[model samples]
Target: MPDAQTPQLAFHNVSFAFDETPVLRNVSFELSSGETLIVLGAAGSGKTVLLKTALGLLRPTQGRVVLFGADVTAGSEREWFDIRSRIGVLFQEGGLFDSLDVADNVAYPLRNQPLRQCPEEQVLPKVEESLKFVDLGHTLDKYPSELSGGMRRRVGIARAIVTQPELMLYDSPTAGLDPITANIIVALITKGRDVRNATTVMVTHRFQDGEILAGFRYDTAAGGLGLTPDHRGDTQTRFLVLREGEMVFLGTQAELEASQDSYVSKFVPHT
Candidate 1:
């Protein structure tokens, strides 16, 4: 078993800047094997930049991005792909291939691999199973152009998890969708946490988005994202409120709500 002390995913004093423009400053956090890490930041607050850093698409100017204690800051692309395979990321947009139908799009990742885990016969069943999880079984023959935004997002999710990754990263999964559909997506995400024992990371700004995450929390192990016994409420979840690329507050959800800071208060819900 992995050490209880070693975090599954970790960022330590991570600082990154583009030329003179600073994005993330001394950001640090740890996510366990089965915990859900929700990141709340306003528009242009470097949330996306942080995801890129985690994915190795962006390198940190200082500190480290660690996965299972292995530093990713200096790895080659080929070296990174090994780590990337263990992670599944849901992009802001569905990021589907318009040319391919849903099934093909979901199966695309397996096609590029140099070796097959199972026989060729296993591919179709896995594809079907993945789509089934997202409730997209009927849309298999349809192209991304033919699907609704919600369906596209679900399809993207199906594609991401088709590989059975250890970690799941969501980038604005509910953006540009109606409230009803967004809620459905939230439920689907929660269901995913229940079905697969995968660590989760989500980035969004809506209070409802925060609420959906709050909903993901519960006293019992069932409600939370498969968190271990050591962490009931002890699991740490903090928010970093950023403005013009600088952090103004770093604390809990309640702390963020009660904050007297003008930037934070303005962003809080009217109620």
Candidate 2:
């Protein structure tokens, strides 16, 4: 078990580029166990790239990426595969395979990841429980094409959480969903954080996603989100804003809202 001092995830001066062009520049942040980081930015602002780099899906051009106190900046693919087994990721648009049914999709990580030795017999039951957590227990037999967009997103969440990873990364989880569906998804994300005490990094375009994360805690007894008392000021959640591949803001909701930077202010969502 990792000691309490180690951060669940950290990016140290990380930068990434695509050929001659840069997509992320000198971006750095750290998320401790059970802490939440909300990433916000306009289109093409490197939000997705940041998550991908942290997950080792993309190699950085400079600096180090650390997971569970280990440096993985230049880790080999085989090493990354083992490290990835301990982290869960929900890629943009659910990223589910249309060829696989819900159960199989959720079971993919368990069966494929080198560190997860989940026995074949235990896969289905674990998959079912994960789906149930996302309120889609009955959709096990369903295919990705059969479900609505929102339901598919939930399935993605189910798949991401099935391995009970210590770190979870969500990229544009509610990008195309309606407000109601989006709120439900964020609520489920909050529930996952509270129930599992997992470290979370969510990249989203919606400021409301960050608000809900900072203002509420999942109430297991009530089976839903409950307003966190004293949430207006102090909170465990923090927000980071990116501008043209650079981190322009990193602070709490209050600090982020108060930021006067023209680029940062654009994400505050004028109510």
Note the residue pairs that clash in candidate 2. Answer: none
lDDT of each: 0.76, 0.92
**What does candidate 2 score on TM?**
0.97
Summing lDDT over every window of 10 consecutive residues in candidate 2, give the lowest-scoring window: 226-235
lDDT of candidate 2 at residue 144, scale 0 to 100: 98
Could you give candidate 2's per-residue lDDT for residues 1-271 as a string of tens digits?
A: 6689788899999988999899999998888888999999999999999999998989999989999999999999999999999898898899999999999999999899999999999999999999999999999888999999999999999999999999999999999999999999999999988899889999998999999999999989988888888874434899999988999999999999898999889888776
- Using all chains and alpha carbons, the TM-scores for the candidates as numbered come to 0.85, 0.97
* lDDT (Cα, tens digit) per residue for candidate 1, span 1-271: 4586677789888888999788988888788787777776778888888888899988989989998678888899887877887788888997899999998898877665433344567778989999987788889899999999999999999988888877888888999999998977776776665466677787777656655554454323454344335432443445556565555676666677789988777767875
Worst 10 residues of 1 by lDDT: 226-235
Q: Which ranges of candidate 2 are over 4 A from the true structure?
A: 232-235
lDDT of 2: 0.92
Give the true-structure RMSD of model 1: 3.9
